[model samples]
Target: MGFADYPFTSRYQTIDGHRLHYIDEGQGPTLLFLHGNPTSSYLWRNVIKPLRDRYRCVAPDLIGFGRSDKPELDYRFLTHYHYIREFVAALDLKDVTLVLHDWGGPIGFRLAQQEPRRVARLCFMETFPFTFDWEEFPLAARPLFFAFRRQRLSYWLLQRHNLFVDLVLRLSTFRPLPRSVMAAYRAPFPDARSRYPIRVFPGELPINDRDTEAHRAIEEIERGLAGMPQPMLLLHFHPGAVLGRSRVAWLAQRLPDLEVVDGGRGLHYVPEDRPERIAEALEDWLRRRLPEPVRGALPAARVAAEDDRFGGALTWTFADTEHGGMVAAWSSHGLVMLSFAEDVDDGRAQLARRFPKASLEAADQGAIANLLAAPAATPLHLVGTPFQRAVWRALLEIPPGQTRHYGELAHALRSQARAVGSAVGSNRIALLVPCHRVVPRAGGLGGYHWGVARKKALLAAEGVKEP
Candidate 1:
């Protein structure tokens, strides 16, 4: 097997009287791999190897693909979705980042919609999440769709000849796969009876038709993108197989929080062509957003879906505001810094000065704004003296529409008022830790590190009058 160098643990779950097989390896939060037609979890070997150090990798053979049971049941999109959903539930996979491709897009996204709490982030490639009419289909891809829908032809080709694994993937992939790799792909379905899932995927695609369940799945994805939001990344090649230039743009418009990246010159099977690129993108996004690998089991009963926004480390994002511009950052570590009214470069520089040696990345403006607008429950990573950290924590306890004086805070911490003021000024992260809630004991508003005017505006926004 190709996985000799990167051996993975074999795991299985019985779902719907079929033995669904999957590979579970590594440690920390799970990264679930969902394969499309003709390919199994074996498609993700390259991707899993690189990221196993930081992530727990779970790649499943979707009942009819790899080592999983290929039941005689009709393998429809809904059937696959149910199997995958039950698989996730059975394993209790939480705080998940779905790495999806091909049919996996509809299956994964639809699952996210059904169980909104289960998924945290999504990474997709060559997978369409929106519905399209026949006219919208690419001219080159049109024939393939027509061919797939021809039931007798598709069945003979897919089930009898295994044309998809033998020919289609070979043609779409950028480079020729090794003989061993091809064997791995074909290993599961040596005969027609074993290829039912692959046989079902193509016809299930909603082309020029709306009534199809798969079509409804795409529409559901559209609604899911609108109603609920999470970090998403769309990966595509230059001359795309599925997501051409116009289609990517359409997807961008639909998913405003999406992070777009090029997966180089590849066709639909991006995992085969650009595994490293996908790995790098996943690493960069997960590192910035996740910040740290999960060190231990999450406390019991804490549903991973609960804090799906970003991990507990300090994650930062850049945005433009009426007040010049903003470089807002957060992580599992709460709002570390919000440097407003500064040029992007200057803001990042200021952040560097405040927390030197911290990893920072420029996040999508729209995505960061959504997070900042509705702050998540994350602990602050305050790099200050014990007294200063205590002061910041106390300030966070201050209710909105109320203000605390330096003397009052000092009395609470049993420290000098001057020292408390100095600590407040030293507080690097703003808004989240609520340093602005601390005011002066005298009959005047105290100075603020960001600015007195901004401070006043914050107090006003919180419905607090300077007392």
Candidate 2:
């Protein structure tokens, strides 16, 4: 709805002669988010935004939904499954963390079963993990679901009035959506003709043990549930549409390695209702269970000769800026260290300790002042462990006028706040790496090596107002 909220680049892939729209953001381990009927990739915007800086988040619009082309197919369960299977193959994604909801559960579960090695873990909300007998379905939802199966009436309501987007969607959410959000969901199915897939979705539900193709397909997919144990997480809420209390209990009994968290209050559209809860749960679970592989340790020979790699006399200089007095140093490679210092002699001693192997020389103060003014312009000879280097790189991505919570940065990096704080504290490059932009999530300016006052002053200079 609002580009400010869902600000991600749209991408496309041609699969099965149709242009399938998707959003692929960030880089690292993959988090492939799949949406059910009515909702599209837009369903995951808020969830994706917080995690994208650390993990690669990919959400695709199904062939007949959202920005994807609407081909005139039967839009049956298997048909949608086949398209999604092809879509995954086309992308060649590996070791994926599948985040599914509603119909997405069936599609993603089937894919995971077919290729277990490719899928790393699974997290779902209000998903269809098994076939539902009429009694198993939520009592409140039965009437509308029954109406959806009554061929002619379903067509009249779903297609003619677009009831799925209008009535059903509105009623499903615990909270009322803004007009603009409703419009975004409505944008996909503009007319009756374009609503064919929406009309077909209801009939695809495997209900009442009926002798139908959908039931048979779901039966086959359900058969693999007990065995598909890849660290599953169930983010359930009170009185969800199909995934109610009884059904959740049934699922817990079947799915192994299962961890359940109450996602506060929500209805069918939990993403819209509790996106922050979803994001936090997912970030915590993923960090604990599927931690990113640590970069390999360097060989002994290389570690011994680390200083020789950047062999040359390092130069140092000091500058008095509006914020405070600053000490800056540069090696032949680039700016090696920069920090705010009250005492010039003590700062010099600290610099020597940081680079004990290199010879220190005096440099022009003007050159160091210009580098401080435009930090990004100068190259940096960052010396730290692989993880610390990663934290430094993440620090550079923070926009000048913005600040990130330590926990937020930690989650983004799939690490704990203490670990992130250690990495941030170790940063020697100061303004060039922008470690001062990090703050405590609980609302306070966190500790700064230079001083909290200097951090405040630096932020104020960049137009960032602290809460």
Candidate 3:
């Protein structure tokens, strides 16, 4: 039900006698992310992580998808739409900005058309607003999808073998996905019955009026789009499956306040290939086009309360160290914060900066000493973006007395050196996270939070020779 990369609180709502799972994080204007078939809320994990800091990001595992309950109902287009509408109603989510992908495009657009005022904006990718003709579809993908339309064949491929989770997803992305990520996508559909929803989804594709109900639904959504006045963002990419260049142009002509951005190199699964790019584009759009909603949606007091929900009561103390005085803070969860400082007062001040929302209390001096003595063994209550957490996890893998350059760490994470360096800079638990082990690839020690001298000293103590 959970993955390390998707480190968010799981929330559920009872909708039509079924339990629908979702991840609701941060506060302010709502960003309701709707996923498509063969994927779930897990698809938006990386995309949601950074945006959650500024926006109320809510992504639900649609009924029969991800961790949601799989009722034996007809998993049809209207069925999904009905459940999503009810789910939104249960949460009383108003002034929502829809983030749509794949089948989510049609479902979300229908919601906006039906309840235009409730939805403030729309952002979508790899999703189409209308049904497609056979000729319009990607040539290479047509045969596979055509076969999926056959009930018996689709059952065997999608249900028994799990084709989408196993093969299609890997092919749809520009780069190969990590094994852990693929595992998360496969976790929900472990058996034939569990994958029924996935099998039904392909059949629901409204191609050339084949699926009358879905076709009509999509046409209705399309016809009403030009009249809808919400601001929209279209993240288009090359070699698209559902939404190609022509579709982007079609959307631009319809959406009055549309802002289109090239979401970099990606295929059907844009989120997997370029989550950072997608997040940056969406964030920029929000900041520039809808600053009022982004900043002024929630009351200041309410915002503070929601943000401080974690690390409720942090106990902190100063631990004397050879290099300098060290500050340490811990919550019931684990060690929350640790840093190098000048003195006891300086240590306390540093802890205040780290855990501003936390109600600070004096911890046992002995416990703080024990933590300093063996920090690697202490469990860390690390707070960071998924990318930052990934980098920190890799950092922990580096043995003591060893060092890795920024490029090497970046290569391991399948990220750029600059991005990895940014994550390294944001490390909270200093010595334990081992950011000091990361040096400049060219030669010498790079920048450190405490000081270069302190970094060199820490590295030397770990038996790492200065380059």
Candidate 4:
């Protein structure tokens, strides 16, 4: 869907009682676009319209920017993190492909680490997750910060008395933004009152040692980014404030797998200046990195458990007295069988007989097992083909906290919507694998091998909006 064609939506959520504004468009592999300081989802306007044909694009204004409510909230790292977590939870997006820039680096990186298996890949530009190690600020950046600190001075200096947006557009691009495009960027904050976020953003930068709290979060994000094995593609602009050969080299040394794109002589806003190149890079990376399709049967001993956390205790018992806690058995290679038993120990013994070499571990901090013991959620193992496995891996990329529909999944898989449904039904490690988050094309709860009621409960508990 085109930018204009997609309507903006708002929802009143309990988190801070803020009305979060977001745009959800198209169908396919989810592309979560996150904006940084002084800008909103509108920064993605030029890029999203082109990529939406092949991917679902969901972009939201950070709590204090764009059409979202700007309350007297603490504008700290943790606060932004909470909003982002709630935003995705409310929508129930999964298997997410994150597109980050500037401040988005830390925000999106934290979310990825929170649920590593849920993120498929990452694409970021002009961003840094490091702290204390940042290169010296550029001379041009100095003026910007100067303007930022002298809020009163900047207010009168800029003819319109709103230099934040003007500076963003001017310094953001190597080439001047088109007149119309520049106008659109400034449209969100028409007056000084609406520009509080912009005025306060620079002061939020953790530039020195005294800014401990924000710097600590930055350090945490840097450590997480360093350890992430997920494919990361960095699109960097040359000769920009945040981009340079030395910084690029540093990142390369840190994230050896990271791919860096040097937009020769381009400005910080690489997405706007080189949209097609960015799109091509993303498409190529996805094709090369996505795992090859493999057909297989669900292992019999592997049970599907659902809960808020994966490492929790079992909440229900599928085994009887004879086979305690053992719900299914599977061949080492593929096929598995499901059995209901009265005895938990007998179930374990039965599963051991089926696959002596298979290991058992609680999923997601014992959350799944806890849910299984209480029967508070659905538990089922899915069996399917190699094509289905590829489909399942794609499903895992949805960020821990987001959801998508069957049609969107199909588009991401480059298959028919019906085929996507069939594959989704075959998922075996539900909750841990997160197939429960995928819904129907009409935005309703879809089928679940365990039961539809369980699916609804899980989605509702996760804060997903249901039709």
TM-score for each prediction? 0.67, 0.63, 0.62, 0.63
lDDT digits (tens) for residues 199-289 of candidate 1: 8888888665648877776777777675444557788786767788888887776663467887788888888888889999888867644
Best model per lDDT: 3
Arranged by lDDT with the best first, the candidates are: 3, 2, 1, 4
Clashes of each: 9, 0, 0, 67
Q: List RMSD in Å for every model shown.
A: 15.1, 15.3, 16.4, 14.8
Worst 10 residues of 2 by lDDT: 297-306
Can you write out model 2's per-residue Cα lDDT over 136-246, one digit (the tens) per residue?
777877898789888899989899999888988889888888887888899999999899999898888888646788788788888877766456789999878878888
| Ranked by TM-score, top first | 1, 2, 4, 3
For candidate 2, give the lDDT: 0.80
CA lDDT of every candidate: 0.74, 0.80, 0.80, 0.63
Over 223-246, each residue of candidate 4 has an lDDT whose tens digit, in order, gives 766566455778766776675778
Q: In lDDT terms, how accurate is model 3?
A: 0.80
On TM-score, the leading prediction is 1
lDDT of 1 at 26: 88
